[model samples]
Target: MEASENWLVESLRLYQDFHAFDLSGATRVLEWIGDKGVFVAGYESLKKNEILHLILPLRLSVKENQGLIPDRDFKVCHGGFSDKPVFDLKHVPETRLLVTSGLPCCSLKVWQITEDSDVIKAVSTLAVPEEGNLWPRLAVFSSMAPGVLHGARLSTLRITDLESQKTAYTSGIGDSEVLSSLQVLGTDTFAFCCTSGRLGLVDIRQKWTPSENISPSPGSGGGRWCADIRNGGQGLGPSIASFCSNGQLCLLDPRDLCHPVSSVQCPVSMPSPDPELLRVTWAPVLDNCLAISGFDGTVQVYDVTCWSGVGSQVEPLFTHRGHIFLDANELDTTPLVTTHIWHPCKPRTLLSAANDASLHVWDWVDLHASS
Candidate 1:
C-alpha cells in the first residue's frame, strides 16, 4: 500500500509537469464570427483544462484570449431557432446559457448548450415592446445577489431579472442619442454612458428619477462619446474609471456621485483628428496599469495611479499593433483598433480585436526583471 501511494503521488507530479509544459509549448487561436457582433463570456469548470467560450458574433468575430480561458476546445453556436444572438451569460461553471435580443419584433431569446450533441437548446423566450434598437449588456454581480442584465437603445436603458425572466426596471434615458456602455457599480446602482458624452446613475431599488448628465471636464467637448465604467482593483468606492472617445481615461467616484475625481489622457498620438478609443479594460492583477484599444490599430498599456484623484498619472508603458479600424474613412490605411480585453486570470496577457478581422494578443514583459 505504501509503495502504491508513492507511485500515485509521483504520477500526479509528473502529470502536473506535463500539463505546464504543454500550456507553454504552443499557442492556439480560437475564432468566432458571424452576422452578430462577437461578445464572449468565459466559464471555468471542475475538469482540468476545460475552456468554454460563449461567443456572440456581431458584424465581426470577437475572439477571446486563450490565456484567460483554461479549457481550449469548446462549442461554437452557429444556428438553431434564433437568427441573431445579442446577449450571452456564463456566471457559473456547470450550467451556462446564451440569451439573444430578437430582431425586428424585439424579444429576448435564451439557449442552453450541450457538448454531446453540439447543439444549443432553446431554453426560454422572453419578449419586450418594440421601443427602439436593442443593445444588450449582461453582468453577474454577486453569487447570491441574483442577476441583473440590461440593454440599451436610442431612448432608454432596460433591465431584466434573469431569475424571474421579466423586466424588473427601465430607465427612460438618453436624450436623442444612443447609450454606448452600461456597468453595475453597486448593489442596485448602474452607471450608463452615452454617445453624446453623458453619464447617468440609476438606482434600480428606487422609483425616483436617476442622476444623469455627468461630464468629466467642463468644455472638454463632452466625454469622448462611448465610455465604460470599471472598478479599480480595490473593488471599493472611487474605483470606477472610464475610457472616453478622445482617448482619455478618467476615474468616477460614485461616493461623490457628482463629477469625476481624476482623469488621465492617453500618451499615444492620435492617428487622425477624429480618433475613438474603442474599448478600455482593467488589467486583472496589475493594479497600476490599464489596457486600451483604439481606432489607430494600436494596443497600449498605461501606468495608472491616483485613479480617483484630479487625474490618474498616465504614462505609456507598451504598445502593440492591433487589427481593428476606427471607422470607414481610415480603411485605406491600417484600421484603428476597436476593442481590447485583458485576460481575466492572466495578469500580463491581453487580446485586441479590430475591424481589420485580425485579432492579436499582447504579453507584457517586466522591463526591470528582464534587464
Candidate 2:
C-alpha cells in the first residue's frame, strides 16, 4: 500500500525456503517448463568460446543446501549461433512435453523431453525455415493450434504450422522498430511492443497493414524493455504489463494499444545504467501479481491493483533479496539479477539467477498474510 519507508521496511522478510547453487559462469536466459517443476536455462561457457545450456528439473521443497539432480540435467546446444536464444516450453498432455526455441543461426527448433524415463534427454525437431534471411528472434507455440508455431524475425511476424512447416501469414510489425516482446492474446490475435515502448495488436485473420498500428501520441516515445500479457480470465480481460527503459510501468489493454490503461513511475534508482535490460513478468497463479527486475540485485513483486495511476507509486508486496546476499558466504552485496521467473503453479514462488553464476529459488510468504 502506502509509499513509505516503513512499508518498504515491512515488506522485507526472510525466505521461507531458500536454496541456491553457484555455477562457473553467468546465466543469460531462463524459462520454465509449464508447471512441471522443471526449467531450461542458458549460461556462459566454462569451455573457451563455447556456451552451455541446461534443462534441469527441480522441486520446491528446500531446507539445507540443494544442488542439481544427477542424470536429470540435460545440456542444450546453441546450434552454432553466439547470439542469445529465445525459447518457450509447453508441458501439457503430461505424456508429451516439449520446448520451442529460436536459434541464433536463423532457425526455430523444438526439443522434447520424454516422460516416464529414468534419464532425461533433449530430442530435436525440424528447425523453422530462414525466411528473408532474418534470424528467428522469437518463437512461441500457439495455444489453439497444436502443431502451429508463431514467431518473429526482428520486426516481421510469421505464423506457421509445424506439422506442415509452411508459413500461414506474414506481416511487418510497426515500421520495423525491433519488437522486444510478443504475447498471444488469442489463437490468431496477439500483441507486440518494440524497444521504444511502442505497443501494437495484430490479428492473423486480418490482413496486416500500416493502419494496424495506431499512431503513437507525442511524448510517448520510450522503450518498453519487456512486457507480459495476463490471459483473459479470473474476471479480468486480457491485459499487458510493460516495463519501460525510461523507468515507467505501463498497463495496456489488447483491444486498444494506442492509449495505456494506466502508467506509473517504476522503481528504478537514479542514473541507472542500461535500463533497457529490465524485464517484467506476470505470475501464472496470481492475476494481479507481477514481478519486475534487472534494476539491481533484488526482484520486486508488485500488485497492480494497488497501484494508483494518479497518486504516488505503490510499494511492492514482496521484495526478494536473496541474490543481494549472494548466498551465505557473501553478505550485503548486490548482484545483477540476470533473470527471474514465477513458478508455473506456486503463487508466490520465484527462481532467480545472478551474473555471478548464482541461482536462488525462494517461495516468499503470502502477501495477504504478511501484510
Candidate with maximal TM-score: 2
- Mind giving the per-residue lDDT tens digits that candidate 1 earns over 228-327? 5555422555455566656666665655545766766676566323433356666767766677666466677776664445544466676654232222
Worst 10 residues of 2 by lDDT: 43-52
**Which parts of model 1 have CA positions greater than 4 angstroms off?**
1-82, 85-94, 101-105, 129-134, 140-148, 153-155, 172-177, 209-213, 231-238, 268-277, 306-314, 322-332, 368-371
Tell me the tens digit of each residue's lDDT in model 2 across 1-371.
13334434644554555566765455545655444444444433333211233433343533333665444333342222223343333332323434444444355554444444333344445455455423344435545454443444333567765556667777754445556666656656666666666666666778874222344323335444667777672234436777765557777666566666677776666323445346788888886888988877778888887554432466787787666544433534557777787877767778887766687777777647756
**What is the alpha-carbon lDDT of model 2 when measured against the actual structure?**
0.57
At residue 59, what lDDT does model 1 achieve?
Answer: 13
Per the 3 Å backbone cut-off, how many clashing residue pairs does candidate 1 have? 23
